[model samples]
Structures are given as C-alpha cells and as structure tokens.
Target: MTSIWDPIRIGRMALAHRFAMAPMTRSRAQADGAPGPLAAEYYAQRAGFGLIITEGVQPSDDGQGYLNTPGIYTEAHVAGWRRVTDAVHARGGHLFMQLMHAGRMAHPDNTPHHRQPVAPSAIAPGQTMFTAAGLQEIPEPRALSTDEVEATVRDFVHAARQAIAAGADGVEIHAANGYLIQQFFASNANRRTDRYGGPIENRMRFAIEVARAVSEAIGPERTGLRISPGSTLGGIDEGPEGPALYRRLVPALAELDLAYLHVAQGGNEALLGEIRRLWPNALLVARGGRPLERAAADVEAGLADVAPVARWALANPDFVERYRRGAPLNEADPATFYGGGAHGYTDYPTFGRALVAA
Candidate 1:
C-alpha cells in the first residue's frame, strides 16, 4: 500500500510526500504585479506538502486578470519571487510556479495599464471579474493575430526562464480554469479559421506550441502543465468534442517527457481514466472539496501518481502533520481568502503551536 506519506519523484525533483499543494489565487501580490512581502512566509508555512504550486502568475503585462495577482516577466517580479523560493528551499521543499495568462477573462480595470484583454476570438466570457473598484462585467476581448500568438509563446518561455533564475524548482503551465490556453481549447471561446483554430488539432496548436517553447527554454525535466477537462468555468464550451480534445492533447504532452501532468478532475471519470492511461509519465489528480482519504485511495489504487489538495492545504499550513495525527482542522474563511494581510495569509498555526496556545 503506497500511503500519501511515501516519497515520489516528479521529473528531477524528488518529493518528500505524495501530497502536493495546488495553486490558489490569493490576490496577495503587490500593486505593481510583484509578489507581496508576506508571500515567502505564506508558502514556507505550507512546506510540509510534497510540492508547492504557486498561484497563477501572469506571463506578461496583458496576462493580468485579477487585481494584485503576481507577474513573472519583470526584474522586480523575479526579485519578489526569489524571497519565496529561498524560503521554501530552506525548509527542504520543492516549488513550482504556475505560468498563467488570463486571456479573455481579464478586466482592463484590474490591470496596471488598463489594456484590453486578448483571447482566441473577440467573444466575451459573459462573466464578472474582481477589479479595484469591485466586481465588474468582463468586456469583449481583442483577438490575437497569428504573429501576436507566436509572440505570446515567447512570453511564456521568458517567464519560465525567469522562474528558474529566481530559484524555483520548476514551472507549471496553467492550461486549466478557462484561462488563456483553455480559451483556445474551448470551441465556443475559440471560433477562428486560422491554423491555430478550427479542428481539434488546430485548437490544440497554441497550447502545444507554448508547451514546446517553455520546455525547450527550461529543460522538460523542469516543466509541468495543469489542465481541467470538460470544465464550464469562465463560460467555456468545449462542446461534444471535449473528451476527444483531451485524448489528443494528453498524449502530445506525454511525448515531450515533461515533468508531470496535473488534471483538475471535473466529474469526468471516463476522460480522467483515459488521461491516466495515455500519460506515460507522472500524473497528478485533484478532486476538489474531497476528503484526504479519497486522495489516498486514488494513489493507492494506481489511478494517479500524486494527489493535490486545495482547501485543506489552504486552511491548514501543517496539513501533513494534521492528517498524520488525525488532528482537528481549522475551517477556511472565505471572507479572508483574497487580498488580505497576515491574519489569513501566514497566521495559520501549526498543530503543535495551536495545541500549545490552547
């Protein structure tokens, strides 16, 4: 029986446990798109997890979607992240920065430049996003030209290199959650006739190109990707071809021999099974809002090599310790989840510390 406490290898990085900390947008970055001052403490506190996947970090200025989310394209951004990476490494933990491009989900008011959001097409997601003022409607996005699309690939490559330079163990391309890459994958979100759109292969071209460029820039051993199959978030409609699209995409990613493929399970058991079968390398599955025992069962049954825990990891910094001792967990407060100070960020006490205080 392979318990979640057992060690595992994902690419060149060896994890101390099978529990990985999934990326969650905390909106705690500086106003200039740099990581907040307490970012290091926040991640370091959760170092008990086998791997720490940082929140969605924009690859370029136009990638900004929500206010105070971090960016990885600037010197200041690199400096800000260095503090985080150093803190995690000192605690003997591995960290992967998730490179995310917001695409059509972005609001101009949320970004520093107030520039129009870009997507695969001009269609809007028909959703609201949090801005400086408050929640506002998502406006129609400008479609990227062929040349611009190629340029965006380079932007992801640049961000991957920056993450490595800042002392990160690796980078995970954020292809999930109806973001830029998922926008290209969804049929309704992408209705172009160019080589980068149309058929499943064409729709997958942008994601493959971005992956290839990032893998080439920073060795494949230091790269990973996160994908959400059949998700309807951000108004994405992959239509009836959703499963078929992933069947093609997963194998293509496996051919690159990248670090790992993280699947955010969205109630598609058949597609999830096929993804696990097609992927020859390490596969990580995330079952949102599920108990830790379910994650253990998945790994024990060989359904997944690793399992990512989100909410529990957020509220319990000493999640591994709590699970080990069967200790009570602190409930996560939704009110303080985003754009907060240390009160909700780094103030989560460890099991031993909490007991002492009690």
Candidate 2:
C-alpha cells in the first residue's frame, strides 16, 4: 500500500511525498496580470507538500475571467512568477503552473482588452461574476472560428514556454473546472460545427492539440493535463457521453506519454478507477468535498499516485508536518477566501505558530 508519506516521481520532478498542493484561484494578482507581491511567501509556506501546483494562470489576456487573476504570457508575468518559483525551489518544492482560459464564463469588464469573451461556440455560462464594477451577468461570447481555435493552441504553447522561462518545474493544462478547455468538453457551451465540435473525438481535439503543442514546446516530461469529466460548474454539461468521453480521451492523451494526468473526481469511483487504469504515467487525483485526511484514500487504494488537497493546504501552510505529528489543523475563513491580502493569504500559521485572526 502506498502511504501518503511515500516518495513519488511525476515527470522529471521527483517529489519527496505523495501529495500535491492543489491549484487554487487566489484572486490577488495585479491589474496588469502579474502575480501578487507576497506570492513567493504564499507559495513557499506550503512548500512542504513537495509538489505545489500554482493557481489558475491565464495563457492570454482574453483568458482572464475574474478580477485580479494572474497571467503567464508576458515578460512581467514571467518576472513575477520567477520570484514565486525561486521561493518554492529554495524550499525543495516543485511547482507546476496551471494554464487556464475562462472561455464564455467571463465578463468584458474583468479582462485587460475589455473585449467579449470567446468560446468554441457563442454561448454564455448563464452565470454572474465579480468584476471591477461589481457583480455582472456573463454575456454571450463570440464563437471561435477554426483559425482562431488554432491560434488558441499556440497561446497555450507560448504560456508553457513562459512557465519554463520563469523557472517552473512544469505546466499543467487546465482542461477542467468549466474553463475554456472544459468549455470545449461541454455540449451546451460548445455548439459549433468546426472540427473541435460535435462528436466526442472532435470535442476532445482542442484539449489534445493544446497538450501536444505544449508538450512539444516544453518537453512532455514537463507537461501534465487536468480534466474533470461530467463537470457542471460554470453551467457546463458534458452530456450523457461524459463517461465514454474520458474512457477514450484518457488513453488518447496517454499516447503522448505526458508527465501525469490529474483528474478532478466528482465522487465517481468507477470512472476514476477506469482513468487510473487507462493512464500509464503518474496519476494525481483531486477529490471534491473531501477532507485532507481522506485525500489519501485513493493513494492507499492503488487508484492514485498522489492526492491533491486544496482548502486544508490553503488554511494550514505546514499541512504535511501537522499530519505527521497529528497536530490540530486550522479552519479556513470563507470571508477572506477571495480577493484578499496576506491576512488569509499568507497569515495561516503552521501548527504551533501564533494564531492570527482571520
């Protein structure tokens, strides 16, 4: 049985432990899309996890979906992230920058160019989001032409290169959580007749192409892909073929011999097990609505190589040490969960450190 403390190797990065600090959105980046000033401190504090996947970073200006999220396709962005990656590496932690695009789940006021959000089809997520002016309804997005779709793939490739230039150990393609790549997986959001639409193979095309391109740009050993099949977030519905889609998609992505496959499981044990079997490389699984203690269940069961934790790791920077010593964990405050400063961002104390009011 694989214990949570067991060492694991994912891609070319050898981790000292079997858990990953799950990628989370902090909503604290600069208006120009550079990472926040305390990003280095924020990430380094959680470096004990060995594998720290950073927040969802936009691959382009058009990929911004919320206020103050970070981007990775610019010199300033690379400079900002270099500080972060350097801090993590200093503490013996490997960081994988997650490349995310919001698609139609965006508001014009939230982006740099202030242009309409783009998706595979001209559909809105029917959701409201926080912008500079406050909450606003997400308007209908413009459908991407086949030519524009190809350009988006290059955007991901460029971002991957930028991540490497910034000293990241690798990059994770965010094809989950109702983002642009997940939008393409959604039947409701993606209604185009292009090669990237219609059948499951077509819907899976953009994601695979982006992965292949990113792997080509930055070696496959330095690239990983994340997917959440049957996701309903941001009003996505993968339709009835969702299960079958992963059954085929996982194996297809495996042929690229990518670093690892991170699956965001929605309590679907059967599907997750099938993905574990299909993927030949390291398999990192993130379980929703589960405690950090429960996060190791998949790893112990031989169904996952590593279990990624989100909220617990966010609240307790020294999560691994606490688990090792059986220390009481701190609870996270919902008030400072988003768009906040170091109060909740980096003030979370390690086990015996002085408690700060959140």
Candidate 3:
C-alpha cells in the first residue's frame, strides 16, 4: 500500500509526498487585498505538502466577497504574492494561487471603492457576508450582459497571468464553494434566460469558457480547477440535477487536459469514483472532511491522485512527518482560524522541533 508520504507526480512537477494543503481563507492580508509581511512565513512553515493551494483570491474588485481576502489583479498584489511564492519555493514547496471570483457573494463594504457585486443573473443569495462594518446583508447583484460575461472570462485569464508573474507554480480556478461559478450552477441563484442560464450545458458554458481562457493564458499543464458538485452554500441549490450536471462538466474539463482536478466532496465515494473514471489521464485531488485512512484508501484505489487536508495542514506544520511516524497530532484552534495573526498561521511546530522543545 502506498503511504501518504509516498512521492507522486502531479502535473509537470514531481511532488515529495501525496498530502496537499487545501485552500482555506485566512483573511490575514492587508486591507488593500495584498499579502502582508507574515504571509510568506505562514506558507513557508507548512511547505511539507506535495502541493499548497492558497486561499480564495479575487481576480477583480467585483470578485471581492469577504473582507481582507487577497487579490492578484494588480501589480502590487502580484509583487506581494511573489514574495510569498519565493519563500515557499525556498523551502522546496509548490504553490498554486486559487483564482476565485466571488460573484454575488459580495458586500460593498468589504471591497475597495465599494463596488457592487455582479453575477450571471441579477438574483441575490439572501445571505450575509463578513465586512469591515461587520456582517452585512448581501445586496442584489447586477446581471452581467453577454459582453460583460465574456469580459469576466478575460478577467480570469488576466489573473492567471498575474499569478505566474507573482512567482506561483500554477493557478487553480475556483469554481466551487458556492462562489460565482457555482452560483450560476444553482437553480435558485441563477434565474437568467440567456446562454449562461437554463439547462446545465448553457450554465456550464460560462465556466468552461473561463477555464479555457485561463488555460490558454497559462499552459494547460499549469492550470487546475476545483469543484464541489452538490454544495449549497450561500443560499445556492442546484436541485436534484446537480450530480448529472457535474457528470457533463467533468468530461468537458478533462478534454482541456489541464493540470489537475481537485474535488471537494464530503463523502460520496461512488461520486468520487465516477469522477475519477471520467477524468482519466488527469491528476485527481480529493479534498473533503475525510480522515487520513479514507483519503489513503481513495488514492490506493486509484480514485484520486492526492488527498488534501485543510484544517489538519493548518494545525500541523509537520503533518507529513507526523503521518509517517504515527505521531500524535496537534489540535487546531478554531478561534484563530480566520482573520488572525501568526499565532495559528505560522506557529504550528514540526514534530521534530516540538520534540526538541520537549
């Protein structure tokens, strides 16, 4: 049986282990959406994983949904991220900047210039988002015209380019987690009658176009995507037809031959296996709340190429070595998970270093 510490080949790079750091929003960046001084140290401390997916970063101001989340659209943002990537690479780690457009999941108070949120449709999620002024109710989003929709695709392309300029190893387009792309897939949030709405094919067209644009901008080998087929966060409901919709989307994405496909599924072994079958010849990453044992089983069974653990990676900087030695793992602090300083982000001690302190 292949262990989690086994070396694996993902994309164009050979990873030292199978464990990956799943992207989680830390909300520690500067108010201008640029990474702060501690960003590099935070990532550098957890460079043991085979790959690290950074937090959801907006591709444009319209994509800013949460307060203090980072961005890669501007030159300064690019420079800030370059420092982060440089630090991670110095530790022999690979990083991918997640290009996330929040779509309707935005509060004007959270963004610079307080721009209104936009989506495939004008409908709102009837939810609230964290802002500098506290949690504010999400306002109605403006519907994007066809031309504007195309422009959004271009925005993703530009963001991917910026990520490359920022010294990132690659880019992961965020199409999951109840964000803008997934919002279009949900029947409740998307009520448009245009090419971006209605049946699954039409709704999926926008996502495919966006991915194609990014893949074209950067080589397909350096581009990846994340998806959650049945997620209903932020007042989204794709209905009972959710699974079928993803059935089609997977093959379409596979056709592009992008770097890999990272799937976030809670359980659904059958679904994971189905996606693995459809996405043949591409690297598959399965990320959910599964335990290490289950994740290893998935990888051993060829259901996934890698298993990503978010909170585990956050709390255990030496997660790979701990897993290898069967050492006791440290519990993560929930309070400091978001919008915190270096306490929880970079303070996790490695097993060897912790033993030395002991």
Best model per lDDT = 1
The TM-score between candidate 2 and the true structure equals 0.98
Of candidates 3 and 1, the better by TM-score: 1
Where model 2 places Cα greater than 4 Å from the true spot, the runs are 355-358
Across 1-358, the per-residue lDDT of candidate 2 in tens digits comes to 8898888888888888898899989999988899999999999999999999999999998888888999999999999999999999999899999999988888999899999999989888889998878889999999999999999999999999999999999999999999999898878888889889999999999999999999999999999999988779999998888899899899899999999999998867889888988999999988879865686888999999998989999999998888888788989898888887999999988877744433
Ranking by lDDT: 1, 2, 3
User: Per-candidate TM vs. native?
Assistant: 0.98, 0.98, 0.96
For model 3, residues 16-97, the per-residue Cα lDDT tens digits are 7777889999889897789978999988888878589999999999888888899999999998999999999999999999
For residue 189, what is the lDDT in candidate 2? 85
- RMSD (CA, Å), candidate 2 to true, equals 1.5
- What are the clashing pairs of model 1? none
Total clashing pairs in model 3: 0
Better of 2 and 3 by lDDT: 2
Candidate models: Cα lDDT each = 0.92, 0.91, 0.86
